[model samples]
Target: MDSIQQFLPIIAMFAVVYLFMIAPQMKKAKNEKKFAAELKRGDKVILKSGLHGKVAELYDKDNSCIIETMSGKLKYDRSAISMELSKSLNKPEAKS
Candidate 1:
């Protein structure tokens, strides 16, 4: 009983961490993956490096994409895209 009591606090701490931190992180990663996989040509996106461009082509086999920027077309890994920033960038403006 004493050993169980000592570990109770540690177990509760892990539960709290998983619920507050780990769960949200896993959800965000799943959403990001869905966003990356659903990417199609002509969709605007922002890279992790802050460079913005439109999807010019997709290479599913390589898990990469070609982005068309004002300067030129560049290739990047799908994981290099920023999901949150791209969602905000492509969000329709509200007229108010």
Candidate 2:
């Protein structure tokens, strides 16, 4: 009974940490993987550098894509794309 009292706080702390901190991160990673896998050419996305562009081409490698931003068609590693652009899908505003 006394051992339970001592270890209970540690177990509770780990559970709380995992629930609040680790679980969300894992969920986010899974979602990002799903999103990335679903990406296709002509998808508008924003990069980590805050440059917004449409996917000009998708390479065979993971997250490797050619983005057409203001500077024109630039090859960016897949991880460079921060997030996908959900709106403003018409003729591309920025040319390659």
Candidate 3:
């Protein structure tokens, strides 16, 4: 009983950390993966490096894509795209 009591705080701390930090990170990663898999040609996106462009080509075999920017088309891994930023960029603004 005494040993369990001593370890209770540590266990609770770990639980709190998982709930507040680890869980959200895992969820975000899952959402990002789903976003990458759902990507298709002609969709606008923002890269992790801050470049904005439209998806010109999808290479499923390599998990990569070609983006068409104003300058030219560039190839990059799908994971290089930022799901949050891309979604925000594509979101329509309010009329008000």
Candidate 4:
């Protein structure tokens, strides 16, 4: 009746927002997860901590990666790796 009519617009707006905004974000996150799980050694990557390095080692069972930083090899969780870099982490290091 009247209550349903009044609430319909609000529900419609929520659905619209989820479809246009939230759903895409979730989909992108899922794809990112798939990418992260497939990471391997020597794959240049960008971490959530902003650490861009080549994956020197990957422990699949423990879910950790050894990143080659300027200082030395650094370890980080697989979840902390945000994305795979397009080029070698070393190539850019020697330039600067």
Candidate 5:
């Protein structure tokens, strides 16, 4: 009973960490993966670097994509896309 009491705080701390930190990270990663997999050509997206472009092509074999920007088309890894910013950019504007 005494040993269990001593370890209780440590176990609780670990649980708190996992719930607050680890769980959200895992959820975000899963959502990001789903977003990446659902991407198709002609979808407008934003890169993590803040570059805005449309998906030109997807290379599933290499997990990369080509982005068509105003400058030119550039190839980048699919993971380089930013889910949050792209989603917000694609969201329809509301009228007052």
Candidate 6:
């Protein structure tokens, strides 16, 4: 009973950490992976570094892709794509 009481706080701390930090991170990674897998040629996306371009080619085996930008086409890892920015860019503008 005494040992369980001593470990209670540690267990609670771990639960809090998992709920507040680890869980959201895992969810985000899963969503990002889904986003990456769904990416197809001609879909517009923004990189983590903020470079915007349309996907030119996807190398699924290597998890990399080539994007066509105004300057030229460039290659980047699939993980470099930003979900939030890409979604926002693809959203239809609202009229007031």
The top-ranked prediction according to lDDT is 5
C-alpha local distance difference test of each model: 0.97, 0.79, 0.97, 0.80, 0.98, 0.96
Per-residue lDDT over 2-46 for candidate 5, one digit per residue giving the tens place of the 0 to 100 score: 999999999999999999999999999999999999999999999
Q: Candidate 2's C-alpha lDDT?
A: 0.79
In model 6, what lDDT does residue 8 have?
100
Model 5: residue 77 alpha-carbon error in angstroms: 0.4
lDDT per residue, candidate 1, 27-49, as tens digits?
99999999999999999999999
RMSD of each: 1.1, 5.8, 0.9, 4.8, 0.7, 1.2
Least well predicted 10-residue stretch by lDDT in candidate 2: 83-92
Provide the lowest-lDDT 10-residue window in model 5: 84-93
lDDT of 6 by residue, 1-96 (tens): 999999999999999999999999999999999999999998999999999999999997899999999999999999999999999998899999
Each candidate's clash count: 0, 1, 0, 0, 0, 0
lDDT of 2 by residue, 11-91 (tens): 999999999999999998887777677779988888778788888999875658898888789988877766444334433
Best by TM-score: 5
- Model 4 Cα lDDT, one tens digit per residue, 3-86: 999999999999999999999999988987787778877887788778777889988888888999878999888888765443
Better of 3 and 6 by TM-score: 3
The CA-based lDDT of model 3 is what?
0.97
Residue pair clashes in candidate 4: none
Which residue pairs clash within candidate 2?
63-78
TM-score of each: 0.92, 0.81, 0.94, 0.73, 0.96, 0.90
Candidate number with the higher lDDT (2 or 3): 3
Pairs with steric clashes in candidate 6: none
After superposition, candidate 4 runs with Cα above 4 Å error: 1-3, 84-96
Tens digits of lDDT, candidate 3, 12-75: 9999999999999999999999999999889999999999999999999999999999999999
